[model samples]
Target: MTTLTRARTGPFAADYAALKAAAWLTPARERAWERLQEAASPSERRGNERWKYTDVRPLTSVPYRLAHAGALPGLAEVKKIAPWDDAWTTLTFVDGHFAPALSTEPTGRVAAGRLATATASVQSLLEARLAKVQAIDEEYFTLLNTAFLSDGAYVHVPDNAVEERAVHLLFIASPATSPRVAHPRTLVIAGKNSQSKFVESYVSLADSDQHFSNAVTEFFLDDGAQVEHYRILAENEKSHHIGNTRVHHMANSRFNSISFAIGPAIGRNDHHALIDGPGAETNLSGLYMTTNGQHMDNNISVNHEKPHGTSRQYYKGILAGKSRAVFSGIVVVKPGADKTFADQKDLNLLLSPGAEVDTKPSLEIFADDVKCFHGATAGHVDLDTLYYMRSRGIGLEAATQMLIRGFAAEVVERIKLPALARYVEGVTEKMLPEFRLEVPK
Candidate 1:
């Protein structure tokens, strides 16, 4: 196995070289990196399937510098941005390195800590399920993360253990320097009959300082376990974010994921969920709000590999200014996965004439007995509705804002945690101003 010991010194060296130098690189990851180095740069045109709508030139233009391990965020500053209101445990990371003094150990049935400092027992558990949930071959960034993963959070909920408060993992990206990159990896394991909720948020300190956050989150749920995972990406507008989340559900298990992307100059999120056992259920929802010159993309897939599994996915985007948005969703039912139920929908509301949105929802089923459906819609807010609201004593801007809020209410209400739901509402309210929606007094 080839291990990465230090940051690369040259400008010509690929980003993978820096990654390889930052962490322990297994033989598999090394080989994957080699392939990435040889692969040709993707074309910027809209003909390519993966890069159909979003342009990749900005990401490929600059070679990102590795975030210095010495400039991690302070605990006092991180606490200010913590989004949830739970007495639950907390794990803090600065520039992708774990800060032990800033984080809280798990209480009762929950176990959370830094992966680099985890004991042999915890390491064994992680080793058993790390690469089992999702494949990292397709995307170069994921392969880079696998090749150079060093310090991040590790959480494990034992069998039948249920926590009253949600566990929070706040990843703080404070770049003391410019044009830096950090890869934060989180592994969450929910044991059989266990229940837990985890909230992961990414925030940056400065808007002009260019930073890249490439994060990967893996969730493994044992038989009959239930897990609700929420991810919020609200970084500076000048930053770039590339994130991938993989979820695996076992027999009779349930997994729910809600991801909100409200910031970043350019962001691409890939979500994958696998129903590996019978009677498993999965619910995936996402919301992306983009304004100005920002660009955001979301690609997701759900695989029903076993019989009698249920899956639902819905994604919505509100695009304003000249910003661009893309959403691609796919649901696949394999053979013998009979009686499986799957549905997917993607909707986009273009708030500006120049704003653009590209949405595609697909269903691929090999089983004849399965019920699967997919749909996509893109349009502007209803002028008639806005006019009606304005005539009923509401200002034009406030009326338009009310309609947009109502459009997102379905997905926001689907959030099971009351406190978290309200927090998300507040974030949505803050986003209205960017979309030119007036705040009603």
Candidate 2:
């Protein structure tokens, strides 16, 4: 195995100074830079509360350069990653640059497109909210995103409006020779009494020798608003992916988050949400599959800051080969936030003896009259189920795949959109054949 050389200078040393100002996003970009300059490198971060169970030195070691627009991918190639659906409007970005020729602009009671073409109101909204949700000083990659933020998309759903079709943002990372990086930012503003569904997916053109994609997406849901969000991640073993997402819920608003993950050398997902209003609810669930020697990490937290708020975090993972996965989740109910209800669970199934999983599910409750609980379990496939399948004339490998699919059904079933769920199932089926399967000893 080839090892990446550690950087002689501090991480992302030259990359920060090279960020040029954009047209309208210059102010926010400059602010992020000012804060990032004072932030500590990921290597300097050492603790169980934040950096436990995952090491990102190899990722930060590679000298990083921001990716410029490469050749536009053909429609067929783009569709291969995410199939086209008439009921959904699509926005495609290739190597961090918005690809207008290959995307379908959102229509009907919504204003959405590249930031360069945003209206004054939308641009102003982004200026105030770009790095607002995730403080730049807190996380290294998130601050890096805003500091070097070049190009991305934005959406605004009007009050009392219903976006008839789901909006899909497809970010494709093209193959590169060097360890290039792309900071793709997406901002969604849902107005009061509005409702919409969104799909955000990350796909690689192919496995590159060295590549990094640091993406951040923020969604703010106003009172009585409802948002159903689905996130999909598919890179390669040679590339690295870091996804940071923040969702804010207001009074009477509800949010449903369903995530699917596969591929990448070191894939880390940071999902955080704040239930800040009474009668608000959030349902968060995800399914991640790891194979070969890949490393996948999911760090999730939901903070209930108001009374009568509800949140759920349920995640399951299937592991094969010698891969390792980590799930660290927490539910925080602050003082004065009484009548909060929260539940969390993480379950893992290991197909090979060498495969491993580290799961930590916990809760911090400082409020009275609240209900919060968490549990985690890791184990191997059941031999009795294999025997039963074999008696029914199922081949060993096929039966194993069937069991893995069955294990993930609970999370997949939670996807409320029928068409989207079917598409996710199809993608999962395609990835099943590539797993480096080994019978549990």
Candidate 3:
């Protein structure tokens, strides 16, 4: 991809100046701005294999108003959207601005979130981790996130601490009179031997407003640490979502993540986990379902830099109507990284003649002794199976929905948290009706 210039990053031009004028500017942000100026330009996307399947013009052409601390829904309404009450700690943001009134403080922790009123300890973690992450450095969106960075929720789990409850970082996109955008950032620092669960969700308060949510989340797992991560993207059909998630795993640490992309007119998310030390384990799974004219893209990768690392990647997609989706899963093992076991797979099902999907699952192993595998498949449901269900007196739509659920169950069932699983089930079930196949007579 060709590097972008100041005028080439079209969509953010209108708000770039405003973003730089903020009084809380930092040296890191200034450096981010410089990098963003040289980041990838969408104009050259079609020629790049990474961008060949998904067109990013929808995200690059629109002028956006900077999201501010404006009017927002009350706590009761937000609960209807998020619906998670048993969280160990809850930190909420509206249009990327912290909502202290709606957030809850953790009772028995050093500090849970970074608020303007954050404790000194929590503030220290934010300063150290936010702009210093170099794991998945220098992609276009990552730099844009830092260049326009604002207030964020920083979750810090101290060394050897066992966080009993999950941490919820909920971000809402409120309706706006004009096209608006926000850069929401979340950083989780799990100290050595500590354990915690993290949930990062994106939802819209308005049904069909034009809003762009550019969000970035990073996880720093120290040695022997364990972190369970869940990322959900369910926004209005008229909105757009572009996000980047980075995970840095040290020696003997473990990371398990499940991501769901079930919304947005146009969406793109990049998830990368770097196994920087030996004995680290990473498990990643994702599901994306699209209907109507929506477009969604998921780019996931696991990089092993040391020996004895293990990683698993499984992703699936269901496409219907005229919708489009792209899935790219990759595993890379560096030289001398022996005994690294990595496997990745991507599967997609098309339910309509107009539906389309592009999936690529690959492995790059520099170590000859490493065990690596990758596979990808895209196809429609079996006709005989559908007919057999109908022969058993099940209606066509009901039979199709059942099959769709069965196909997606593998990834959904991966959620270890019961409460979050139920919530995710509710969200995924609501969108099943949209995936019914266009059965021809």
Candidate 4:
């Protein structure tokens, strides 16, 4: 593994000593901490090529104390924020500590709990596959999360098992006296010929609270496995949110992911996938809505390491006020990976004059017999559409909101979880009023 010697030792380093002593440190975790300590800081902060558009300096500079054991005093606040109305089994974590008080027991063909409570069989599965998809040298935030990794959702489905309801993992950040940070690490394993769905949500108790959330999740799909994953980011507007999700696909497996970024003053969500075997298929989709002084960035990359693999990426963003948004999509086809098919597209709707978006869609193809394409677009709502709606007795605000929602619906509709999809649509509708229709002159 490569190391970054120039990486700045940030706030995480300050709490490293206290954090390691409290948790039952394993050799793997110790190695990860060393990697983070040695790795260079986020290159994007230095105005580097990968993170040039989105500025995260303000977030990285804050000194946030890491959350420890018994952080959640009660479950009253968590129940209100987490979606527990349905029958889905929920594994709740408060301030990165698994809260059994607010979670439901896994009762089906699935095993779900904190890593500590994992059965021997489940532990074996996790030990064999936990960090295989995400490398420690790739990103600063990823390495940071792995170093402090303690209790998080660990889910496993046996071969040929099919789950009826989606498993929900809720990571709720409570108000802290001072600035605080939480690293929520989740590992999901789908056995061969198995199928399941998962919904992972990050939310704050109130909008006034200020905190930072650094989360990382990994998904392993064996041959003939199918998994649908949803990541919902609804943190407080005063908080900073950074998350990384890595997925590995085996032969004849399918993985679909939908990420919604609707909160946080400064947010960055990354979705990366590695197609390790032939006949694997993946669909990566995202929706980001930012308003006021918010800044949101969505980064996605899909690597095809085997022949006959297919992947697609679709990301859309809505920006209002002086908010800034970024969409970077990179698809790489390795040499001799013939018969690979990939497509990438990004669309942005700017609702204010000061709103900005930087989009980059690139495809690297080393094989001649591959079909790859990428495209991006950023602009305001169509004046003609607004005019037509006004002529039909619809008000300007309503008209603009409709158009913006329509743009985001394209991606939201693809989510396989019905309840989650509906909830997201409702949230998007409520967010529409934040933007106004200014007919372009």
Candidate 5:
């Protein structure tokens, strides 16, 4: 693996200085700073693996100022986005720092809070697992995030402990002046026999401020543990987003994730899951809607390391205007990973002549006894389906809307949470209607 070095001095000189002066700096943070200092600066249309599908020139062109931690959002504003159900616990972070005043820590079974305020006992756990699941070496954005991370939320679920309510985390980037950057790191550990749900939301205050958000989340699940993770990205239209999510599943553990991408000038999501124990299972699904000149990419890799593990992934994208979308997924079965069942599929719908899509789905199985399959498809709406609906008395626009809603419904309906599923569907409806789709009563 190639190690990325940090930048000594350049356009980010003052930003680096401010990071060093920040009061929340930690040893790990310092290590990240040193690593980024050695890495080369970003450029327009760089063909690096991490930046291949998405060009980050616009983000690097502007100098983003450091957001003041003192100006974090108030409790009332945080609660506005909270889940309607009282059973769930909510945690809010503003400008990358956790706000305890706007959070609720579930009783006894779990511990949740800012890394800075965590006790030495909890910090030890974080230190042991942080940055252990994913490789951050080749990705410059991940390195940048590690270097500037001040404070973020942390959740730990003990062995055999079960929580009835889900955990909701909201990260808000509010910039008072100039462009701002926020790096939010989240770590989750689920012990054996435990079950939980995690929901994360990323939003920005200003669309034209040229903000950049780099986020990383790691999850470790023990035997028999079940976890459902949901990520909603609705940042400003002019913001740049680079996020990485890594999950490791042990024996009999089950992991599920749903990603919704609705906003961002440019977006890239890197997701990877490893089934290291027998009987482990995983399900990953995502939906992205892009318009105007926005760009969105989703790259996923699943590794089956043991026998009898199963995994499935499905992702869909709707692009209009001159927007572009990309999806690359790979499933690998180790030599001894017999009876591993894996399948992946990606579907992209282009709503405009100029919209573009790049999709590649692949499967690599070393074990003869494994069952794996992959498929990818990119095309515009089916005119036949539209004509059939119109023939049945449905308006052309209404028929078009129905087709899109149905295409997106396939993934959104899989969401187990009722409220969240409804919210996601509502968002899709609003965004899809703009593509000359008619709403069916």
Candidate 6:
């Protein structure tokens, strides 16, 4: 394995000084920068368990510039791609910088804007909940996200406000004059008895040049609040994407998170949620599809600190060509978390001989009277099922594609949003091989 080296006085180090001098430094930002300085050095990837299956040597070997203001020119065509209809409030950021001209105004009792220009109360809420769920320790990618955080999404729903429509945040990465990187941060604070929906999408407008996107999001749900969060990643295949999300649930709060990943040459997502008070509930579901030489990693963990908490996690992946996928999940029930119920399942389907996947699911229970279970499975499509379909006059190749679709449809069906689920199905359809198979023209 080849080792990568990074220059000490590279773009990141230079950005640190420039940001500090430009008054972009906050107490929290300063703390994060100091932490990154200590841990962001280039080193051998063999020792880190997180980097075992994924080779990130290219990250340090290349020196990419940081995204700057007005780096992307004004383009009208690039502003038309939105995940949701006009019924939903949408916020769009180009190259990690908030684009007000392309975003829709919010309605009702919702505070949605850029984190850097958010209200004082919203900033206070972020400060109180940013790292409260998952601390930054030994996670170099997350620390890097914190250190370079500039402008991203910030939303707050006040108490008793039930938002009828979902809030959409779209982050689009465009090719710069040179290879560049963007650190986008999102913070959401849901007050007591509040209910809302959030959708986050990371995409690219350009097709060719290599870019890197490092993003982090934090969600704080007060008691009795309910929020459904959806994340979609479909960057350019030549780009690199790393995303982290930390969710904190208070007593009786409910959090539902669903994610889909389909692009990027190398992509990794780390998600963690904490049940701080009693009776909190969480449901996490995800799907990742890769083809050709792409590689993806999804790491998730949930900690139950109070009793009567329930969590269910299920993730599925479809690998084709020589692509590789990794899924690792952990559920922990701490002491005094009696009556906690947790179930986790990870399943992967390999369509090609060269496709590969690594799945690991774990449960740690330190409390008595808790119900916990975890299981992981990786294998090719069921031969028997395919045979039965082929016997019914369906071509073998088409039958195999149908079986793969059914395997992934299980997770897609779990998505409550109808349009989103259909969008995922469409993406899945396009991802499969278009074989004539004597079945379709």
How well does model 4 score by local distance difference test? 0.82
Error of 3 at 73 (Å): 0.8
For candidate 1, give the lDDT: 0.79
Which candidate number has the best lDDT?
2
Candidate 5 per-residue lDDT, tens place, 1-441, comes to 333233333665577666642243466666766777667655424445545676666777767666667665665554443333445677777777767676776665777877667777887887787766756653566676766666777789999988767888777877546777778888898999898899988877555666777888889898999998889888877888888888988999999898988789888878989998999999999998888889898989899989999999999998888889889888999989999999999999877777888888888889878888888888887777878999999988788778778878887887878878776776677666666532223
Give the CA lDDT, 0 to 100, for residue 325 in model 3. 92
Better of 2 and 6 by lDDT: 2
Clashes (candidate 4) = 2
Tens digit of lDDT per residue, candidate 3, span 1-441?
A: 444433365566666666643334356677777877766664355456666777777777877768888986898888676647655478889998888777888765535765344566556566677666554347677787777765677778889988778888999998888898888888888999998888889988888799999888988899999998899898889898888888888999999988888889989878888888899999988899999999999888888989999999888999999999988888889998899999998899889888988888888889868888888888887889999999999988999999898998999998877877887889878888878888555
Candidates in order have lDDT scores of 0.79, 0.83, 0.82, 0.82, 0.78, 0.79
| Candidate 4 lDDT over residue span 1-441, tens digit each | 333235665556667756642233365567777776666656544436666777677887777789765557466666555444357889988888877777888878988888856767667778887666756345678877777776678898889999978899898988777788998889898999899989999999877877899988899999989998888999988999988888989998999888898889999888889899898999888899999999998888899999999999989989888899888889999997799999999989988788889899999998879999898999887788888999999988888888887888898888766777777877777777877654445
| Per-residue C-alpha lDDT of model 6 across residues 227-273, encoded as one tens digit per residue | 99999998888888888888889999999889999888889888888
Pairs that collide, model 1: 4-20
Query: Model 6 — TM-score against the truth?
Result: 0.91
Q: Over the stretch 1-441, how does candidate 1's per-residue lDDT look in tens digits?
A: 222222222342454454533233255456655555544344335345766777766865667766766755566665445475647577878788777666776788898888777788787788777655677555656656665666678889999998766788777778546587888888899999999989888888765688888888889989999998888898888888888898898999998888888889989888988999999999999888899999999989889999999998889898888899888888889998899999998888888888888888888889878888888899887777787888899988787788789888878887877767777888789878789632223
The weakest ten consecutive residues by lDDT in model 2 span 1-10
* Over 4 Å off, model 2: 1-15, 134-136
Question: How displaced is residue 338 in candidate 5, in Å?
Answer: 2.6
In candidate 6, the residue pairs with backbone N, CA or C atoms under 3 Å apart (3 or more residues apart, or in different chains) clash, namely none
Q: Count of backbone clashes for each model?
A: 1, 0, 0, 2, 12, 0
Candidate closer to the true structure by lDDT (higher is better), 3 or 6: 3
lDDT of 2: 0.83
